[model samples]
Target: MASIQLQGKIFIIGEIEAMTGLHIGGSAGELDIGGVDKPVIRNPLTREPYIPGSSLRGKMRSLLDRHLNKPLRRDRPQVRVHECNRLADYKECSVCQVFGIAPSRNMEDTMPTRLIVRDALLTAETRERFNEIDTDMLYTEVKTEVVIDRITSAATPRQNERVPAEATFGPLEMVHSLYTLDTGSEGSVDSEIALFDTVLMGMELIEDDYLGGSGSRGSGKIAFRKLKVIFKSRKHYENPQSVPIATLAEGDGVSALRKADYQSQISAAMQA
Candidate 1:
């Protein structure tokens, strides 16, 4: 196995706007505020609702896991999702490469997890607005969802707290790194560009798919808006003289980004 080489880091900056309500479950017993059964996770200090990085990353990985339809491993029964345990499988699996997997006995089989998702918090403007306005809770709202009990077949009322629709969580940043790994090369595709595209695909999938809990019954519809991608080469960090490269389309939103085919632009920029 060849030693891994640092290629660069890509930053995906954007705003996650809730097209519909979003409910990422929080600790129920933590607080008895509002009497709502389900509450969205919040910052312990501020008590203002925010999206967890785990929830955001997990949802994207899960969507890709299903989209790729990779065969789930039998050995690790505890891990419910499909994981590429071997060197050969890890090289072939995009979900494992991008989202990553736990290292096995063969150290070369796995590399560092390329993606890092930051906890999304409400934008300054939005937070200000929320602070001023009257809400069921601080910066969040309580919604009642009536569900049916399977055995009893009775309508059960559930009060779920949510970040209301049209609310924006901004300065959303996702960092994806580019590393030349020695898992053994399979193709000529640039590692940086491929992983970048995989991350974009995850974001796209998440846009179509609901996030958080109660997605099927309507809760977590979200949109990535004002998206931009920036690249910082290995030299940029070591040397102050190096300038970060900005690779972005003409317009805002994910649709525009897809239309621009960011992979091609990023590839070009990386080489230049």
Candidate 2:
């Protein structure tokens, strides 16, 4: 009998505070008249903040690999058409075929190519806060949906390369979920931390769509965006410790905190 193959999917759940900026296109745009410009309006019912899908997908992929203890294959050529082998091949068979290069000449190293984050929600706590505010009432949390458009990248050619790489995945779809965060609550930070730690400590990338739903209130969905993967697990040595920087120097203070302890802090606060 032929050898049977088994595949496993990993599922991860966590909260991400908007670190940069985020924006969604309105239903319409306006032209400047008399030295003044009016912005387009969007549907009031579906007022969901836009979180880039690339952001979610990239983070998830990193967490997934950490959980699985498997390093992604990164040495493969960027041009897929020039490469005959698929990402699955490396996952299933550990084989990669290079186009215009002989099989023997093909590099043996493999890196993760497809990192997807589908059916994601913008922290449930964020949604609940939005709901608590009267339609007529506005709050800063409404602006809590960070504007991620201008979050600049680090000064690294590889980091620059991946930004475009992530864009190739196409527009992403955003979904909303109900997450709770209480001020003066114990273990809040810990709760988030625990959740993130759990995700990073797991293996596999599973499918989930808990946030995608349609109700009488209409569809509550998030926006989706794509990003390129120039490099994964890039590391920088600082103070005698090696830090994993997704895109070179992008792993500074806050980014490093997110990569290391932010989730745990949230979890702890939630628990408190």
For each candidate in turn, the TM-score is 0.87, 0.27
Which digits, one per residue and each the tens of the lDDT, describe model 1 over residues 11-91?
Answer: 888899998988989999886668789888888998877888889999888888889887865556576677776788887
Model 1, residue 18: what's the lDDT?
90
**Candidate 2, position 170, lDDT:** 23
lDDT, model 1, position 149 = 88
**Model 1 steric clash pairs:** none
**Among all candidates shown, the one with the greatest TM-score:** 1
How many steric clashes does model 1 contain? Answer: 0
lDDT for every model?
Answer: 0.79, 0.28
Give candidate 2 regions above 4 Å deviation: 1-4, 24-45, 50-55, 58-116, 131-272
Residue 152 of model 2, lDDT score? 80
